[model samples]
Target: MTRSTDRWGVTGTVTATASATRAAAPDSATVAVTALGEAASAARARKRARNRAATVRTAIEATVEVGIETVDHRVTNSAVTFEPETDAAFRAVEEFHVRCEPDAVATVVVEATDGGGGVDHVQFALTDTARADLQAEAMTAAVDRARRKADRLAAADGLAVGAARSITTQPARPGNEPVDDAWESDPSVHPAPISVTERVEVEYELTAAETDMTVANDSGKG
Candidate 1:
């Protein structure tokens, strides 16, 4: 009959976080239109104001060259409201949300809305491709850090860290949230850095160290 020694192992659990950052540029802006008009008939006044607002929206769209520049735009709000004044007037207020790349184009979009509507919000953000790449980089760094910690811990206990048995990861979170960056007219100038952080918990297998193996052999001989 063959005798087998009981297997021994230790799980090293470690949590590590890593962050990656890139300069954020303006990726989107909001154009708000308030077209006001007064007519003898309420319906006519509302129609006229709404039509004017629609025209402004069309002009803004043309400036961006939607398909060519590959921009994402949508009408966020459109409503007609009346105010009590010397003469009843209807104001059609509409907001257009625009997002695109090569941030410099944002200036062109704002100019297009000029004389017709006002740009309400200009914001900075990371592109989808950039976000994905950074996330991968951060995750890799976190895993490496976890492995280093595991190795150190195992060394302390006269053990060798082996292959990872299991790994648990947390969703990546933005360290800094996107915000209005209208203060800087030039989107490329002194852009703020956006950081993404990722956390991971890893469990690694442990193997017997050389010293432990020597002691086991000595006991067997006795």
Candidate 2:
């Protein structure tokens, strides 16, 4: 009976040890939860670092601007013509055409007048080549003026004028385009001025030249 009692007591002790071991076992689920938390924390830190870097980059770049203006000169050349015609009633008509020959003339206009008698009037345009030559002359004059101006400016600044960088010319507007019916009915406006204008834009560079100078002293008293 003592042996049996001892055996039963030993068995009961073993069972209790097993139960304690089961209770102390770690939960795999809890391990996964701790790992997830660590991963989330690392991701948040990376995102914050990226955002800060972007902000720094944005603050590094900005800018300002400036502007400049220049002007050019032009000239206008013109000619006038008139005609008188006497018929049933002092009626006269004047007409003109653009001439390009003997001179470069544009905007030839025509007008009619009641001269109180019957009179016939006729007007012709100058040669086209002549008008074109005139226009060329006008452009030449403008270029000369521009060169002179550049020379003067350079002289004032103690610099030498260099070669022209660029040059451009534009045609002038015709005068006929400006006349209306109001001017057509009045004889006072009979000989409308025909004009052609030319514009020139020029650019020149400036340079400096070296020169030698000497000093001399003169004293009569000495």
Candidate 3:
């Protein structure tokens, strides 16, 4: 409920948030490169690690043959020093976000890294086309919710709901984080449902009921 102006031009504004969920499988996974060696061989190890990372990235992009939608990678270097400050070894780490089928995730990562690194995280998300559809539905639901609330408030006050004067919506928020590892226990298992939420604010005009207008006319006559 929101503000109103005059008695005959009452307004009912409602803000509502509505959610829609879609069952999704793990379509993407994150993998970390574990390439470390003594400082003496840091230069050589870094090269090999980069090569391995490159190979993994290529494999990920070529997974579906038509090419996966997302394949991102970043490289980082860190040094671990012992009690003797001089005794330190550098490590080259590369992480990738690979899009692939849930069932083939392990196989792809293992084969790509030659059984060196392991899967770090798995995520579930709707494809671009599906996401757009879901967002539309969610937004509609939010607006409907606001409308219902406004109607109820108007009815309680002996007023009829009228045309919408204004409407506004916020961007939808889609959840795509790695929720669980149930896929590890069962390859065919689907990921948890992903929810998208949309918020809307609507302003509706409130008009006096016909009975109320008739009563006012009778009073004026008396």
Candidate 4:
């Protein structure tokens, strides 16, 4: 028998790849309200936008006690421009983000978009705790799937599987990084389920021949 060992134990090596997917309702929501205005003067345009934003903020504070905190929200984008050569009007823009519970999202969005409101967008997302928990569960499921696969393949070849020699994950895609989830909020809308997937590749070493490969063979039948 030929034997070789480089990274994942001896030459009797088997590799298993699998992906686990999990779906859950979002736990929280974030609403983005953008206030924009145009006026003859820069200061006047800015004031108009701020006034409109304040009205929306007051509406939010009434619905939810959290209110739009100034420190939490920031001016993500802003600019001023002249209307034309003859016209000296300036346009102003400001955006504020509001974080609130999933249940309260509908109420807040309605208030923001009501009566020509300044709501640019409303988004739904999973809470930090929910995200972390789901990640752990998905990872466990992927590993279990890989191990089971390895066992069945080894049994078919009249061999027994040993400890994993190495384990690694495929490089994530360019835009696969975790990004803040957002959506347009509607009263009758239900938050979409959050789906998380975990992919893993494991290499296991062949220990010895299986005397009775009944379990591995039977499990694969179903």
Candidate 5:
């Protein structure tokens, strides 16, 4: 006859999957500023475009924030009007990005756009410290959810929970939805919540049932 000890293996393992989410407030804001100029002469158009860019840079320097940084300031287009009317006319457009303390986003936007610039889009994001903290919480919540589900499933199968045999985790990313655009114009407008979600699939071993049943049956035979 085959012995129960020889048959012991990974049989009757239960797998559980679940996901958890948590919201965190964003700590930084990014804004895009663009400028366009048209002139009767190519030289005049170039000078106006340069002046517009300079105006934006100076405005940025005057603004107060925890800290402000500019990046990717570029000229998108600069050409003379030839197809429509070659009357020595030219047009130019330049764009730049600004990152600053969350609270200062609206003021910086207003000041930068005062020089005939337009806002392209605004993004609110988490700080390093906040991201780490939220990620930890989300993972714990996901694992706990998996454990609870496993317990119920194992009990229904007339088995008890045991050590985890294997586990898989899903990394976190930026929230799926964008923050409110209106917050760009009015800093007082609270941003929509930023969320982090995590998913985990865990396989847990279930205690052997035949071993205990055999002992009971032997006692009855005695």
Candidate 6:
């Protein structure tokens, strides 16, 4: 009887072990399904966030502004001809204005003699600072005019004009520098115009601050 009881107890222990192994298999499968569901949800959320960011980036890139340039110029000239014994005498008078302050000199001696035809010596000097001041004023005025024109253009194009980024002033190219036969024929008659020009380059930033056209309409109504 003792042997039979011991054999029954061993059989019960084996049966219990088999039941627990079968249960564990189903539990593991359930846990794997739950984990896979969580991973899929997380991936979908990440993709949505990336798409939103890409849309904003595209909008900003489209609203960037382009740069523009404006220019202004003014030119004037003076003539001086004298009966000097030699070319050297007229040249000396012209040289006098070289060291003199631009403000002090009114007349600019161009040449000592008209080499084209046997004429008396001539001298021409560019009036210094005082005359340049007048030209500078004219140039500044021209710049203002250009700015107005730019404003009108910006308005027409639906753009906003920003402050000037840079400004430059350059003398007009001298007519004498060009050896056109037409100009040489009457060098005295065709004196080079003294020129003062102003140029500016400006940068403007453009943006479509909101996607909703309603925002623009609200602003207008307000």
Superposed on all Cα atoms, the candidates' RMSDs to the truth, in angstroms, are 6.8, 50.5, 5.6, 7.4, 5.2, 44.0
Name model 2 segments beyond 4 Å from true: 1-124, 170-195, 210-222
List the pairs of residues colliding in candidate 1: none
TM-score of 2: 0.32
What lDDT does candidate 6 reach at residue 88? Answer: 26
Task: Provide backbone clash counts, one per model.
Answer: 0, 27, 0, 2, 0, 16
Instruction: Output the lDDT of residue 199, model 5.
Output: 82
What digit string (tens of lDDT, one per residue) describes model 3 on residues 1-222? 554666554455433333333334434443333432224456754666566666665655565432333233323233434453334344444555555555565556555456355455455455666556666777677777777887787777787767788777755454532143433433345566555566667777676767887888788784
Superposed model 3: Cα runs more than 4 Å off? 1-39, 54-89, 101-103, 170-188, 210-222
What does the lDDT come to for candidate 1? 0.53
By lDDT, the best candidate is: 4
lDDT for model 2 comes to 0.30
lDDT of 4 by residue, 101-218 (tens): 7788777778777724566666777887998888778778988899999989877766677888888876434444344455654555776677777778889887656544455556
TM-score per candidate: 0.63, 0.32, 0.63, 0.75, 0.74, 0.30
On lDDT, the stronger of 1 and 5 is: 5
In candidate 6 the C-alpha lDDT for residue 39 amounts to 15
Worst 10 contiguous positions by lDDT, candidate 4: 72-81
Off by over 4 Å in 1: 1-49, 67-88, 171-190, 210-222
For candidate 3, the per-residue lDDT at 135 reads: 66
Best-matching candidate per TM-score = 4
**lDDT, candidate 1, 1-222, per-residue tens:** 011235552334333333333344434333333444446555666566566656655665666643222122222112242334424443333344545444444554464456365555454566677766766777778888888887777677667767876777766465443344453445445445556665777777676777887888788894
Worst 10 residues of 3 by lDDT: 65-74
What is the per-residue lDDT of model 5 for residues 130-149, given as tens digits with 9 covering 90 to 100?
A: 87787789878988999999
lDDT of 4: 0.69
Model 6, span 1-222: residue lDDT tens = 001124212111000000000000000000000000111233443344334333432332243321111121111111233443333211211011112222211111121121111112222234344345645665566556555655555444444344544445444435412121112223334333343333333222222223333466687783
Which pairs of residues collide in model 5? none
Whole-model lDDT values for every prediction: 0.53, 0.30, 0.54, 0.69, 0.68, 0.28
